[model samples]
Target chain A: MKYGYYPGCSLEYTAKPYDLSCREVFKALQIELEEIEDWNCCGATMYMSQDTLTAYSVSARNLSIAEHQGCGEVCAPCSSCYTILRKTNRYVKWDPHARAMINDALSAADLSYTGGLEVRHPLDILVNTIGLNRIVDRCVRSLEGYRIAPYYGCQIVRPVYHFDDMDNPTTMDRLFKALGAEVVEDYPGKVRCCGGMLMMTFEDVALDLNADLLEGAVTRGANCIATVCPMCQMNLESYQPQINAKRHSNYRVPIVYFTQLLGLALGIEPKKLGLDDLLRPLPKLAPAKPMEGVK
Target chain B: MGISQSVSPPLESELRSAFWDHVQMIPDGHKVKTCLQCGTCSGACPVSHAMDITPRGIVALFRAGMIEDILKSRTIWICASCYSCTVRCPAGIRVTDTLYALKRLAMEKKIYPDKFPVYALSKAFTRNIRKYGRNFELGLGFHYFLKTKPSKLMSNAKFGMGMMKRGRLATRPHKIKNLWEVRAIIERAEKIGGGK
Candidate 1:
């Protein structure tokens, strides 16, 4: 299947690993990712908080570009991008005032969104569109030794999106299990906030939130936390030292993109998957074992 | 306490009624009036402890005709926009979106708490998007630290350097090829009221 890719800004910088691994995984699965040309930022929560119409107009520009490219659905790997874009889509569809304002704004650049462009998260696309059965057929390496805490973060599931259970999302859990990894079933901080850009604004509060997530994963015997959001990965992984120092605890847990693990399961090289970019190294995965019941 | 007592009842009621009308301007904001006084939003909020007024308290204060107090409090800036409360609210109040509206209102009125980095960060972030059509993380950090707490820049320099060494931090901004289109959209939106 072909999809338009919107990496957003973070994927171009701090979340480059997510971009790399997502490309590799999609390639292995033969899902073509056509990037929308000259896609601007999604106007994340920052712009949304300041100006409503401008934020929607900015985000809608990307949708307009995707629609121009004949892409019916655009996949955003970042949760913030996914949420913001989806929110824009929802408002444009339901709120007439927003629709008129956004379209009028878009008309300035000779672009307009006529609706029907789907804004999707990579996780939703992989687990739902690709399906687990097809994924199992492609797995060349088992994650038998990996105990993964699937950190869903906040955006993808919340605000009553029908993608997955907001409180207890199991798409990642199910995907990890299908790859032969043991899922941390009772991970309390699975859907918790990773403080987003608050890490830059309010370091102490963000650190505390990340600390809670790490402490939850570590206590659940998770060797690493698999995440779907760039901000969550950065906040939870990059802030471990500060969290350790501030919270008076030791935490060396590797926070990785779920796509990276999926890429590994698909037999992609670790380097190609951007595994080396991780601040904390993922524990070595044991060699693939014989299939128990599968062909 | 002193401020409310100083206002005559007629003027206070007028301000309170205006506040209610303003709340209705928010997207799905009318649902806020349906809040059952349940603290579900506060209980669900991960960072409510850091908020000067909890999520539920914002609604309660609105009921108490204290919109100014809510705007000046750190509650709106402290919202992480996690939307936990929005989803969990029994009354289906869009608490997070209300917070966003409050943030915009606070910014418009310049009524936020002083020395709050969230304002600086948001301003820096939006400015970066406007200038480059994408976030320039290094520049964003430089502007944020310079604005809110210049002293923290020294402590953060090492962290920034580490990110740079890891190939995660881009020294230069990534400007989109069609930045003019983004600029046009913003300018047009501004002319069209920008939902202000």
Candidate 2:
């Protein structure tokens, strides 16, 4: 399987581990990723708030680059990027006024975008397109005892019905089970918002949302939470200590990118997957020693 | 505070039509006029407790053209854009998108609550994008921390250091290769879209 990879800005800096582990997992799966050349920020929601046409134009520019590269399908690892790109692709295709306005900006750069590109999230590509059969065939180490809570933040499944249910998505759940981990069913935080854009600006609100998501998962006996979006991973992983301090709770859930777990299950070294690069150390998938009385 | 204190006399016809026109222009925002007042959006909002005005109230206010009455409240800034309200609205109102449109309109009117970090942070983010054609995390942090609210620097300093140590934060901006192209795009977009 081959794809045009659009690893948004976060994957390059804040979420480097996601990009690293994602590449390794795809390599193990024999998937090819061609990073789109000269990609710009997807403007997330902030840019859209400032100016809709400019935001659409910026998103269009990225698609135009991918289209120029002759890539019919472009995959973004970030949920916000995927949503924005997909929205632009769909908007420009259907809304002639928006299309003309965005094209006017594009024409200024000697670029005119004719939209037909398929914008996708990596999770969509992995579970839906690649098929679990291929993934199951490549898993060298079974995560038989590991308990993972799959957290898909708001964007991927909402507003646009791509490949999963909007309210209760199971792509990651099935993906994790395919890798041999115990999927935490009925996890309330499964489709919760991570307050991605507000993390920095509205710290209090963001922290509260993050705490709910972590608490929801850990209360369900999840060893750790597995996530697909960088914003979700970073928000949950980096703020657990602070959340614990404020709430006076002893929660130590290590948030890991789903790709990192996939890499581990595929027999990729921990170091290669950038496990140690996480703000919080990786939680053991299984206990180092058996409990004295539990069994 | 009850809703009556802020209510202005029914909005002038011209102003009411203008507001509706703007909302109707954005995709799916026309649903603003179709709000059922069922309070589904308010119930679905995770941060509604922090909001002074409920999400449903905001929609009602927009439809009523009493935006000035709603503008001062921190409700719009508090929205996490989670789409819970958008997805759950039985009327299919783009609650999230309408909120975003209201945010922009609020910013344009300079009515967002003073000293609110959301405005400052968004300003810093847009400034970074305009300067480099891409968001520079380090630049954004500095701009937001130093320029908007320096007090946050001391509190968030540890997280800042952690990001730097883990190589998650950059000290300098990362400019896109074809920056001129990006600039031209932004310039033309501003010229065309700003006319409104």
Candidate 3:
């Protein structure tokens, strides 16, 4: 199957590993990813705060391009992008005022969105569309020793999206289990906020929020936290030293994109998956066991 | 002595009704009238402790016609936009969206907490998107620190350098080829009242 990919900004810079691993995993799974040409930012939460129509107009530009490309579905790796894009689609489809205004805005650029495109998160595509059994069938190694805390952060499953349970999402949990890893089911911070852009302007508050997420995972004996959002991975991973300094607690827990782990199970090399790009080093996992039916 | 009045007299009736009308204009803002005073929003908020006026308190203040006071509080900027409150609200109140509307109102009025630079970050982010069609992280940080707190640049230099060394920081901005298209969209949206 084929899909259009919107890496968003973070995936190009701070969350480059997420981009790398997601591409590598999809390739290994034989899913074609056709990138939308000349896509712009999704306007994230920042644009929405300043002007409603402008935010929708900006996000709709990408949808217009996707529809023009005949990409029936667009997959955004960043949770913020996924949420914003989907929100824009809903507004264009359901809100006539917004639809007319956005179309008017689009006309300035010679573009329009009639709303046939589906915006999806990579996690949903991997777990639901690809299915766990198919993923296991391709697995070459078992993640038996890794205790993973599946951190969903916010945005992806929120605002009442039916892709996963908004309150207690289990797609990542089940995906990890199917790969032979022990999932941390009691992780309370799974759907918690990772302080997002607040980490930049309000350091203290963001640090406290990240500290709680780290403490929750570490105290539960998790060696690493698996995440789907780029911002979550950046905040939870890169800010550990600061979190440790302020909280007076050492938190060496590695935060990684779930795709990196999935790639590893698929027998892709660590270098190919950008595992070396991680800010915190992952703990040594017990040697992989060969899949039961694999050579 | 007669019981002293603690609450201030409500705003002039005209101003009070105007403020209520503005609140109801937010997406699903009419739901504000249906708020149960349950405090579910505040309880679900991750950053509510840092907020001077909690989410639940914002709705209560709306009923009290104290939106001006709410605008001046740190609560609007402190919201991380996690949407926890929106998902968990039993009354189906879109709390986060309501806060976004308040932020827009505050921006329009040029009202914000004293010395707060949260708005600076958003300005820098949107500026970068407008210029490059995608966020230039390096440019965004430089602009943000300059506008908000120049001293932060020195302290954050180490972290910035680490990111650079890891190849996570792009030295050059990634500009889209069709820059005029994005500008046209923004310009047209602005001309059309920008959803006011």
Candidate 4:
């Protein structure tokens, strides 16, 4: 399963866990993440917001790098990075004027993108590469009893450009079901932003918005929420305590990365699975005392 | 909307003010001033039928501080964050970002909406980041579904079964090796306030 892996800036700095864990998981699944040489930023949605052309050009530069590596599909672990790259690719291919401008911008960096490569998210790669049956076959311990929420943050499916179904994308839900957990059916904010940009500028907007989402989950009877995007992860996990404090509520739902649960069900030790690194310590699913059925 | 839009207003009272304060940080944040209300964004919207306020109206609600209604309305959940409004808006307003800003503000109010499934979705994403450092759709999806009520799980059974048949979903435990490095990274994220 060797492929071009672009971990983006966040994974390298703030979201290193995503990059490192992705490598670890792929290794176990016999998938390989060959880094694209001399990769650069995906514009962080910043360049795009400032200058749309620069955004397209920056993304093209990254795509051009992947092309140089002779890879057909470049897998991006960050949703922001994935969306930015995908959006830029689609624009250049779909709009000749924009393509010309982006191409000209790229030439300033002495790079040329031929628009033959595909940019994909890590979740897309996992499902496409491992296949559902392989994931099912690997799940010795089934999440048969847990009611899980399949979360797809704003960037994954929204805007309906060069992606899956805009409203109801089943990719995340499909992947979760194969892993032995029952996927919750509610349509809670799958494509909604978690105030990613505001989190940087305004504290109240980010924390309060996240609290509302958390409160909704508590009412929905979701014990665990699963997500494929890191920004959503950080927003929900970090904001919970603040929600509890300011709102004076006990919404103690655990915010976990979908991969951590996969590693756990696969019998990976808690430490190895990165269980201790959360805002609120992850609570035990059951009493420490041995359960009737749990090993 | 297969996905819900924001309810009425698009910003909270205090946060609405802050959006402008932060708007200064953004190079072109003032683009909001150009809205002509041609009704193009609302008319073109697939989910406009579901919103109490048109996409254009939602913006008006923001400026008016009729934000509480917007924050509590079902429309916030309906938003797909499609950015179609932004893309197609002749006014070039950051309508999608404003919508997201509304969701963030609404969530802070601790408003619980059960009809939409996004609550679970957001929670699952949050939990995934906390534990795995990344997302595993198969694992997280199952974890999310299993965590829900029995009847809710049944409603999801159809989709669950489809994953089984397609072999696109996992039915087994999938663990990654060398996860210790990932653990350290997560710890750092929290210590550095990536998680509150």
Best by DockQ: 1
lDDT of 1 by residue, B39-124 (tens): 99999999998987888888887777677777778889889999999988998888888788788777776776756757888888
lDDT of model 3 at position B158: 89
**lDDT per residue (tens digit) for residues A1-295 in model 3:** 5588999999898888899999999999988898889899999999988887888899899999989888979999999999999999988888888789899999999999998888999999998998888889988998878899999989998885759998899999999988888889999999999999998888899999999999999999998999999889988888888888998998898899999999999999988888888888777666778878432
Write down the TM-score of every candidate.
0.95, 0.94, 0.95, 0.61
| Cα distance off (Å), candidate 1, residue A28 | 0.5
Q: Over all chains combined, what TM-score does candidate 4 have?
A: 0.61
Off by over 4 Å in 1: A288-295, B1-25
On DockQ, the stronger of 2 and 3 is 3
lDDT of 4 at A144: 57
What does the lDDT read for residue A168 in candidate 4? 66
- Which model, 1 or 3, shows the larger TM-score? 1
lDDT string, candidate 2, B59-176, tens digits: 6776666677676678888888788888888888888877777777767667767577577777777777777777888777777779766897787778878888878887788888
TM-score of chain A in every predicted structure:
0.97, 0.94, 0.97, 0.87
Better of 1 and 4 by DockQ: 1
TM-score of 3: 0.95
Once all C-alphas are superposed, what RMSD does model 4 give against the true structure? 15.1
Which stretches of model 3 miss by more than 4 angstroms? Answer: A293-295, B1-26
Lowest lDDT sum, 10 consecutive residues, model 2 chain A, at A286-295
Q: Predictions ranked by DockQ, top down?
A: 1, 3, 2, 4
Could you report the DockQ of all the candidates, in the order they appear? 0.76, 0.67, 0.73, 0.04
| lDDT score for residue B92 of model 4 | 67
